[model samples]
Target: MAISAPLNTALRAFAMLLFVVAIAACSRTPNAMPTGVGNLGPGGGAPGSQQEFLVSVGDRVFFETDSSNLTPTAMATLDKQAAWLNQYSNYRIMIEGHADERGTREYNIALGARRASIVVNYLTSKGVNGQRITSQSFGKERPVAICNDISCWSQNRRAVTVVQ
Candidate 1:
């Protein structure tokens, strides 16, 4: 026997309502941020998260022009980074070295490599495991600032630490 049209229509409407409710139940609220597996510790990020490292400590260190040597300021930043890495032992890091636009491509690559290596050495010396850190040289390929002046060049000459 066939159901009446009105009854059938009501049933379909009820099914649609249930489907919508189910979907809504599974979805997160608009303002809810996605969190990691464990508790959120300091710096407003989950423990060992990139957000934690960046927000609590710093992710980048600046260098002098044509220099791979870490300045006192850069060393200070590295000290913080090393401490963070030691605390967050589960995370691995990549050090990306960059250079100003004034150097030739080959020269810049070498400079950048030196810069990255120096950062890696510093971190390792500070008790961060050497195996957890890797380095790459971007040369003049990536620049946070672009201009023909010291201001921009200073910003470009740096190494950035990325957590993974």
Candidate 2:
């Protein structure tokens, strides 16, 4: 019951230091990977998996309003997709075309179909087997971003590649 003043102070300091160290040990850096888990590679999926293809090779391409033509940027993404598809030939892909909620239902459906067909054609021309790819149109039935603004409309106009 009679600890010396110096001893008491030292013990308190030691406890404070331990607390600080424990907090530091438990805190993780923003970029630190989890322990015991090996690297998941790009996109956090096994190589050649659908997840890898979606993340690493990109799964979607945006289109201009009322246009099914592929822009240079879209072409670049498609190029990467073609390379990945070629490397993973066992996978079949379905290109889903979507249009912004601007035109009539029939018009949007036709536009979406054109968008999907364009992507299929591009991939086939790049050596991906046409037989391995199919295309469908969602038209305006599906909108990834549902708002009247241009931002949402732009996002809705896209073709997404689904790998099976």
Candidate 3:
């Protein structure tokens, strides 16, 4: 027996729908944020992924223009990060400092390093082990937003926490 053209199209569409459903079903909890403490709790998977860390504990802290100092807002966010770090002692974090596109490459690198160091010091003061944290500067090399305006530059001047 030969299938009709319309039946063949319908079957193909049905198979595609089934594939999509299977993928959706395989997904874990939609609202589940990575606790930063490996999935050793319930799920049998590798340690919490960086994406999860970004979702659960804020991964980036913004800074003012041309400054390495932490603002009150930044400090608040870091406080939360420090608490999370303390709770998940098994995880080590690398803080990355980034600058906007306004300075010479060498200057920007030094500035970025200063920004990252500030964060490390802050976290250390909050009781997070200094040994568990390290910092690097990407300077203006990596930017989250690209534009000549302060608005865009503001987005790029930041310190990001990465789990290792």
Candidate 4:
């Protein structure tokens, strides 16, 4: 087969374009997660790494319908948070309690308070100082997920730990 000059020129241009793209891709570092910025693995790391707390310690824990009791899963998450808090002893935190929109304002506020208290107690038990923590109830006023469905309601019923 004989190759024409114009066809050879086009093939050479296409090959050059592909080589440039490959070089560009290799030079760029992926932003999957910042290096050494987040907790490397589950359970155990020094605090002050905001990325670690948000990604590993998990700032929020969910609860059952109309209940403030901590489930095993919730406890595990709280345990990790407590560990983080203990490591970062100088930091103070606020536990923000929230509720689904299924109850009256007053009722929800009370419920939220209870939930927040439970979280504080658990964290204290896990070696975090009670003095370093405070609690507030948002009731149904603030919700991370807003919808009438169970999925959204479940998300709204949570206690969030805000480190300050």
Tell me the tens digit of each residue's lDDT in model 4 across 67-122. Answer: 99999999999998988788888788999999999989999999999999999999
Q: Which whole-number lDDT from 0 to 100 does residue 8 have in model 3?
A: 100
Please write out the lDDT profile of model 1 over residues 87-153, one tens digit for every residue. Answer: 8898989999999999799999999999999999999999999999899999999999999999999
Please tell me which model should have the higher lDDT, number 2 or number 4: 2
lDDT of 2 by residue, 1-164 (tens): 89999999999999999999999988766665553223665465688887788667789999998999899999999999999999989999999999999989999999999999999999999999999998999999999999889999999999999999
Clashing pairs in 3: none
What is the Cα-based TM-score of model 1?
Answer: 0.73
Q: In model 2, where is the ten-residue run with the lowest total lDDT?
A: 33-42
TM-score: the better of candidates 2 and 3: 2
In angstroms, the error of model 3 at 126 is: 0.5
lDDT of 2: 0.91
Per-candidate clashes, comma-separated: 0, 0, 0, 0
**Best model number under TM-score:** 2
RMSD of 1: 9.0
User: By TM-score, how accurate is candidate 3?
Assistant: 0.70
> How much lDDT does each candidate structure score?
0.90, 0.91, 0.87, 0.88
Mark the regions of model 3 whose C-alpha exceeds 4 Å error after superposition. Answer: 1-52
